[model samples]
Target: MAYYKTNKDGDGCCSHSDGKEHSNEHIYEVHGHDKNEHYGESCGGSGTCRCEDTHKEDGVRHNGANASSKCGCGTGHGRSACGCGCEENFGSLKQTAFQFGTAAVFFILGILFAFIFYDIKLFNFLNLKLSSVFFLASWTAAGYKVLFTSFKNILRGKIFDENFLMSIATIGAFCLGEWSEGAAVMLFYNLGELVQNSAVEKSRKSIIGLMDLRPEFARIYNPEDLNGEKLINPESVKIGTLICIKPGEKIPLDGIITEGSADLDTSSMTGESLPRAVKPGDEVLAGFVNLTGVIIVKTERDVQNTAAAKMLRLIENAQNRKAKVERFITAFAKVYTPIVTAAAVLISVIPPILNSLIFSAPLNGFESFSPWISRGLVFLVISCPCAFVISVPLGYFGGIGGAAKKGILIKGADYVDALSKAGAVVLDKTGTLTNGVLSVQKIIPSKGASDTGMITAEQKEVLTYVLVAEAHSGHPIANAIRKYASENLSGTEYEEFKKADIQNYSEIAGKGISGLYKGKPLFAGTESFVSDNLNGGISRSENSLSGTRVYAAFDGKYLGCIVLSDTVKTDSEDAVKELQALGVKRIEMLTGDNEVSAKEIAEKLKIRYSANLLPHEKVERFETISSEIKAENKNNTVIFAGDGINDAPVLARADAGIAMGGVGSDAAIEAADVVLMNDNPVLIAEAVKLSRFTRKIVWENIGLAFFIKIGFLGLGAFGIADMWGAVFADVGVALLAVFNSLRAAKCRKA
Candidate 1:
């Protein structure tokens, strides 16, 4: 099979076969390369949207792909087929204001009629009847939707919602000839509904704000026709097409900068405060605003696979994957409503029976039991669990939205729960704790290992052999040696060395690569790989080497070693300290690097480390640690942080997986539960803080709803509270709980 590489910094190691680009980093096999290719088709279902397994960014399948529009009308944008979008929150504040305006008009008219005509006896032509008519108008104005929806739900066989409860209690008041009480109950309930709607809309707005990042169109330039440029929908653009971005325009797709340079405001994508500078060969994601200059970019992925599109899809579908708490509340409400209604029925009937049979009291026809029946109605109204059922999920949604605002993408609400209980975080050393860019630390020639001032002939000869073996590979170590040789060797010497004919190039996974350079054999890889090929002539000790050792063998002779080192990120130490302060019980490092190198980095960061492990062994170590933590505290979670294609197994195995999104492979991103948009280790602590804050808000809402409901249940039982009081206890408390739930969106940095 032939292997081809794509643009340098974009999708790495892509093989073009059968007219499709198979991204090697993501495990997409054009024919049979990828084994786990059962990733299902893209989700266009009601509440879920996921990229298919073995799917490539160049060939994205989205829900909106079938539709020719992006109007949220079942086109492939992953939205439901509703014309108003899936949410009913548009202009909610204005709708509430309109309802209040009409209710106020009717209430004032009814009050004037009662005070001037009925109470004063001014107009005696059925003044009480006329006053009742005005109050009825006020009640209709405030409670029309409640009455209509309750009956609609009843006809549909879906009863016992909050609207049904309010409707039955208020109508029961009117039937008992308490017209003013009935009107007042409906009025207060409607007011509470307005408050609840407004608060919910406010929380939802925090998420909807992300929609502003989607670009309207992309400017494409035609290279064949020099003067041809067209503006088209971003979704219509294909991969590998060149698009021009002018200053002040938002980037419409993920691509590589092919021409020009500029500063880009990437806060919407990564939440970084400063603008990033981009030159040719730099990768750029969608939703960033180009601050200055014109840059031509070659699109690397389709619109559906862009970062902005994925973020939007994840958020829109978050509510469908209910958290455990949310599912429990749903089940509880289903049982709670009927049980409370049955108890209310018993209270209305059992007292009458006991009074007639046991006490031998005088029994009037129907009026004797009217007061108890009215109290039972009040009990029914107070029993609605709207506050707990509605506010808990709303709080979690707010938390998810808030985390997205900070550039952390949590796939589902359940992961938010797992993050709250995380006790240990396992970090991969190469890209998670340190920048993965390898640099040449030292070069030792076998003949003149101590030469420092000038490059000798033997040193040039050794470098020439290593360069020929590494020229066709894209590994970081290979690039580092190529870079070192290009900078150290003179132009004439480099060109002369590069002219050597190489053939039969092949790579050995986890070891090194080999080829025939100038018709003689040459190889580069780990120390063991090179020492095996040298026939007992050379055995260099690698214990003294603190960094990665690249050994080279040329024509059955040991050519010596090149030491390459990767530097720790500047924020790694600070990130560790922050996680400790945030109550992470254990922090550990896992890496494939040598013991000396791994221990040096781990000691500096003050964390435990497991060194010299393969990819599968990392998962085994994590499982053992997780089992021990669970034995101590069943609620404790283990989170794994990694950034390579090899890290996907451990990433998916952990309780909560955190990936360095900025430089991570696509497989790692897909396997991770939480993705930190920027490669900053400190964001892990931030995600934990957000989840804990959200959980706090959820419990507060639950506690407040129960406290008020319990008090009102007692009052309704004892005949101390009327329908008007029940309305305040039910609807008013629900409104207050919703307002408290909005606090989840206001989480601050810890």
Candidate 2:
């Protein structure tokens, strides 16, 4: 006896009398079971076998008094069992090829018979000719699927599709004694459909191949049992678990390295070809390949929350968000088809009736109405809306896929349209245009006014107090101050400052932060913020500093200031120039720094500036700029790029938001429509150029399809074109438009 069950490893296997688990490759030999019994239900039906067998047979069959079976073991099976020798069941592609070949042979024979034996009679019923017999056979073989589908659609209240149009047109051709043209129409249409399907499949494969970064399994690290590391599904791993990644293996989850270091290839995540060297303390995201050394990473997030998973989800959902042009084409097809079908019906009846009355001819026989009905059939064939319906959304899908290859994740086709029309670009001062890393440039002590060579005693006190107050803050400026203190202060002094008790901590947005230390008020913020609360205000200097200055005050006495500077990114100036060269009319910068510092950076890039603005003020400024640009041209849009949490509101309020995914906060990324995987400001310009290219290709397809279709529609209506010409107008135009839309997938770099 043989029985099946799921093993501990979740594999479906069967146990025989030998007490050994046999895989599904071995056939089960059943004894004394009735041939008509439904054994598939006990074995989980056809094709649902968890053993991953190829057989999909549902029931047992007896061959020479012996019954053989293949089962799903416990799952819901789908198809027939393997090695069943079922030659009659062929796939759709094979069936289509066979039918087309047979039709082509019959069609050629019919044309030959018409030329040599035109008067030969094949049958007595209705005086069918020899050529007509072959023609009827060719038509049946070529058009059976179309006729069947048309009938089924009519029953379902769907009478205005390509199948219905083609079926009616070809059948009318046969009734009018145009037998050769009728068969040729169906044959050519099927050929065009085959070419279109091939092109669409190629485009889909090329686009989806760019994102092949999913890791198969993760190795659980076991230091105590180093030789026994088990490989399991990445989704099964929990947070804080230690996972080992060997060289040439993909990092399966977002984590921080705890043991060894390696050179990581982050091209799949960031689209940068250079390999980044990572140390033990460096953070790593999922989908990066380890290049050199083995590293044990402590997973920080579950598999679903990794960056790769989120990116895949974004791409999968992108098709659901349609562009305005795509939506218009879809809606137009729905209204256009029924109207054209109605027009074909009127053309068939009215023209014959009017001729009979005006010329005093009888319209009782098929001969009197044949010419007008043939014209109506031509009209019906030319009226198919396949070209516009298939190619419009396909163009947008190719555009999204092209942008994704460059590591720029656009949320939808609507955003692609918005990016192409960018008129004014508003960039945040830090992280967007300038590197957000800040370093202490200079220190000034109020007590020693002339000490420029070395740090004085009062400067040390100021640095220590600033470090103590800003230790718990997570802002970038606070983190910079802490780093500076750690490197400058001695061990004893750093430890003493870290141990100082503090209470009543408060952080005022965009200005500064304050806390009470040892029952004394301490402040580390802008010069004006510190000077306002002090008993004696500091002296105002006419010479403004080049970088941001954070003033320190304690116990109603001013200590000094620390000037921290952030360098502009190497690609910022080039990116700005490229945007201008691309015909962007306005480029501006928004910052919370002092006007002097903001102006210095803005002048270097030669753009306008708005300084001393809070988060809400930044949004208001963006709105004003957007309105001004739209007033000039309503199609113009404003885009904002930022990386900090405070920039989230402005990022959401702009016409299009671009987030620097490398150093940007979660809130900023969540609010943005486009995300640049790396902190390269040049990517913004690249994205604009790509969007324009994609839009141009889409419009080109639309123009080509409309021009060809409209010209043929007029020709067919006036009897200048035949059914063969109508088939070319409908199917030929669709194939050409589809080929043109494929160019959007191969976007050139700007």
Candidate 3:
């Protein structure tokens, strides 16, 4: 196995291969190369690139001119290459348009026949019978699917849907001898169905358009011959494999640029409208299109595991999770349908019987009941519960998609509901609210020490000892110390001093490092690490700085301390105010930093603060805060945000766990319910705003649907409305609610 690097011209890129055959391997295979390049000795054919094979388990693709392969994936979506298995025969916009056109012609012809031919008799059929035939023809033309679906659902014992209700009400009109009314009701209902169906399809197209951001092919090249490029399926791309991305191609997977530069269009993933300029060593996510230049990227993840795929999975899975409002609607519809059917029957029978008996009139069997039965048909049509049942979940779906467009990935509908109710938001200090990079703010000299300049000779020696002890460490604090020492010290003296040998270097967890420099012990760490080791060389009284204090000592004598600080993020204060404005009752910062620094930051942000807590103690404090908030107001919920492995516990335990996905640990990301992909603290407030807006839209749909349906029910029962009017009230209201749900997609603030 070997690792090869690519030049700026996108040549000579390769990765490790074990020289064993796998079914689906990366595109880089060992082959004969030029004498100067070092890919391998010869083209042995022992290692094969999986792209040459045409038959994969899911589908087969052929490269030859006459080769044909059957593809049933994404057949009707007009995106056959993406391999999504969406059904093609589910009816298209063209089909809907044709249906509407034909129905309108038939409806107008039936109207002419009913009005003009009522007195003309043909053969044994009366004028009314001829007109009835014309209206029935129009009904069949417009409501064919509704009629067939009703019959099928009846056979399947699923008899409580809108299809069944519509079928029953219109057919009941014919039974009551209102032929024109029956045909008009079915025709108008189908027209509304067409409109609602088209809106829903348009919404699905918006989401599917986002899913199409994945690239179809990856351009791979051999290390020995960069000119020999191969097109391979993105699914076959492996981690750590080098792939070349040309301009106008979508990035196939999550990766880092190995060479070259590009301007990326990230609107599909982050809704950022601007093209971002990226250079080598910068990480790029999937679903962004490369707008300019050809860059070589080394894959960090497989196609299915990239950020784009994860966001899609989250959205698809959000539908399966029921929000509280959705569940309430489901339960309400289930019980309301059967109760209304019984009420329709009672409305037909009881009022007519009581009217004839109480008024002492002659009750004719057929004629006396006909009027009441017509009113019952109107009741049944108004009883259809499709409006509320469909729109509430659709609203949540739109909300989730809108959040992902902003780079906030919410895992489920329950989380959307939780975010709307968020009250107490607890934050981890290091990375959640602060920049998390340690840099020296100031240098402090011991009291009564005369200056050999502000940095005394003793101080320079102590810095040199600290630098030597921290030389091999890769921690941020250590890097800050090393960088300071390199920049401030005289260059010639610093280069010469770097040659001094040190031994027994070791880093103590949560403390610092120690080593032997020139046969004398050197130490640098927290106040406790330096004090206990140095034994009163510099008293603790002189080291009471507000920032992170690192003391240095050599051979049991303390020189001075360096004050390093992790600055609060630029967005932190505004984000806190936004959270408060979004109705978060309390905000708190939790940290392992000392009390003085914690208090200072909390005061500046004007939020509650807890200090000097260990990882487990942080969780305990969060629990106490949560209980107190709940005790005061039971509706309040606690949300925890963090970006470290130690934060996984609290993230999982909180009502809503938000992980900063950009720099978060794998454990924290996996445990979190919501992931802020850009690591912006302000997105928490934005997410809350989006959730609240979605819930508001959902409630509006619910109230509107209920108000319209109930008003129609009363009017139909009192005989003020007929079946035709009921049809309009039912389907028209449903179409309006569906259109209203689309507002969630347009919500820009969240």
Per-residue CA lDDT of candidate 2, range 1-750, in tens? 332323234343333345545333332323212212222222233322333332334343322111343121111122333321111122233466677788889888888998875558867877778887788888888789889998999999988888888888888888788888888888777766555555544444443455555555689999999999987657568999999999999999998999998999998778889999998878898889999999999998886678776666566567678889988988888788889888888887888888889997787877767777888899888888878887877777777777877888787788889999999999999888999888887777666444456666777888898888787888788888888888788888887886677799998887787889989999989878898889898755523668887888998998888888899999999999999999999999999977888999999999999998988899888889999999999999899988878888988988779988632256866788888888899989988988888888778888988898889888988889898898788888888878877787777643
What does candidate 3's lDDT look like per residue over 130-182, in tens digits?
Answer: 66777777778777888899899889987877788778888889887677788
Model 1 per-residue lDDT tens digits across residues 1-750: 222222222332233344434222221112223211211113232212234223322223222222111222112212222222323443345565677678767777777777765544435664456556666777888889889998999999989777777787778777776767778777776777677667656655565564446665689987787578876667568999999999999999999999999999988777788999999999998889999999999999887688776666656666667778988999999888878888888877778878998999877867778888888888988898878887888788778878877878777788988998889989999888999888887777765376467766776777878887887787777888888999988888777676667889888866888888778888888777787777865545546778987788888888877778899999999989988987889999998877888998999999999987878788899998899888989999998988878789999998889888632257866788888888888888889889988888888889999999999999998899887778778878878877777777777742
- Candidate 1 pairs with clashing backbones: 39-53, 63-76, 64-75, 64-76, 64-77, 65-76
lDDT of 3: 0.73
Question: Which whole-number lDDT from 0 to 100 does residue 451 have in model 3?
Answer: 40
List where candidate 1 sits over 4 angstroms from the true fold.
Answer: 1-79, 82-86, 91-97, 111-131, 184-188, 222-228, 446-448, 456-462, 490-505, 515-521, 532-534, 537-542, 662-665
True lDDT of residue 204, candidate 1: 52
Best lDDT among the predictions, by candidate number: 2
